[model samples]
Target: MPGVMDIKRKIKSVKNTQKITKAMKMVSAARMRKAEDAMKNARSYANKIYELVGNMADRVEADSHPFLTARKEVRNVCLAIITSDKGLCGAFNSNVVKKTLAFARENKGVNIKLICIGKKAYDFLGKKEFEVLSKYVSFGGKITYDEASEIGDKLVDYYMSEDVDEIYIIHNEFRSTAFQVAKVTKVLPLSIEKTEAAETTDYIYEPKAEVLLKEIMPRYINFTVYFSLLESIAGEHGSRMVAMDNAARNAGEVINKLTLTFNKARQGAITNEILDIVNGAEALNG
Candidate 1:
């Protein structure tokens, strides 16, 4: 068994760690609220645009718009992997990485390109044997629409020029404060099945489906990218907050165990000293 002083030192160390985790938990919770609001506000717009595009695409021939046209054969794929710039968020980053890896293996023959959005993704996938078109990081737990627009523009150019046959966004979808689900969303050659609600509704074209699609298609792509980033940011913060809370709880448990060990050790030492004194006094008297 370790000495009482050693146990005391360990208890102190664990306490300090617990404090840090608690602080992180608080910070993450605040950021999560802010990000979550942005994500929520964007949800309505994203859904409407999604519905509009899907309905319009269904009305016109698929090949009428470049964005809606699918390639004959998928030769190259571009994956935009979104993750947090930092760690200590439990399995948040690892989950996205695992999903991405599975996707790569499933399409092993295809030439895979990468667009790494966060440091975690870049640190892992960027160093691999893939062509990384771009890498973005250092957002510091916040991102603006302009940054997302820049990334969206790059993806647009790549798709228009046939740089990649397909583009997919691999990111975490914000489900709740304690849970997030990783999703693989296709970005290029856009396809959305008409929902029951949308199927019942019919729309009259303003200028023409082709003209509207040509003008609004790029904006749709850019907003899609921006919305994905917002979702990812919110999910990351929620995951981190939950992770830090769990860490703090675990540290508290360790501190309690260490305290128990410390008290037992101290008691043993005191008992031993008492025995020594009693024995010496008895011997001297005898």
Candidate 2:
């Protein structure tokens, strides 16, 4: 049996740890709420833009824009992977990395290049054989449209220069505080599905539909990247909040068990002392 002093010290240490975890949980919860709000606000605009672009693509000929045309042969591929800069989110980064790795493995024959958006993804994918075209590390917590535009511009240059034939994005989609889904989506060569509304609706082009497409397609790409970044940020905060809450709860349980043991040890010591005193008194009387 351990001494009371040792157990007391352990309980004190665990209590300090519990305090830290509880503080972290509260902080993360606050951040998660802010992030989720940002994500929700941005989703409306992003979705509308996406729908407009898709519908426009359907009405226009594939040759009308470079973004609308699919390559006959896919020789090279680029993957833009979004991950968290810092960890502590339970399996949030790992899930994205796993999805990215699975995609890389599946496309074994093609030349694969990576555009890593976060520190964790860059660090993990950097060691791999695939060429890392661009890497953004420690990019802060918030994302801006300008940053997404810059990334989009580089990707457009690559596509126009024939550096890569196809581009895809891997990220986590925020569903709720407790749930996020890892998703892989192709961003380039806009998947133009012919819908009934798209086929029936026809509008006169003021400056030619081709010119309009050229102007809007780049924006589409940039917004897609921006939206994905927002989703990732929200997911990261949510995951961290959940993980920290669990950690605090586990610490509380551990502290309770340790306190019980300490009480038992102290009780046993007191009982032993009482027995010794009683036996001494009896012996003296005899």
Candidate 1 displacement at residue 283 in angstroms: 1.5
Estimated TM-score for each candidate: 0.94, 0.94
Backbone Cα, N, C clashes tallied per candidate: 0, 0
Instruction: List, residue by residue over 246-269, the lDDT tens digit for candidate 1.
Output: 999999999999998999999999
The residue-level lDDT of candidate 1 at 149 comes to: 87
- Top of the candidates by lDDT: 1
Q: Judged by lDDT against the true structure, how good is candidate 2? A: 0.88
| Global lDDT of each candidate | 0.90, 0.88
Candidate 2 local lDDT, 25-68, one digit each (tens): 79878888888888889889977997888778778887888888
Worst 10 residues of 2 by lDDT: 192-201
Residue 247 accuracy (lDDT) in model 2: 88
Tell me the lDDT of model 1 at 12: 92
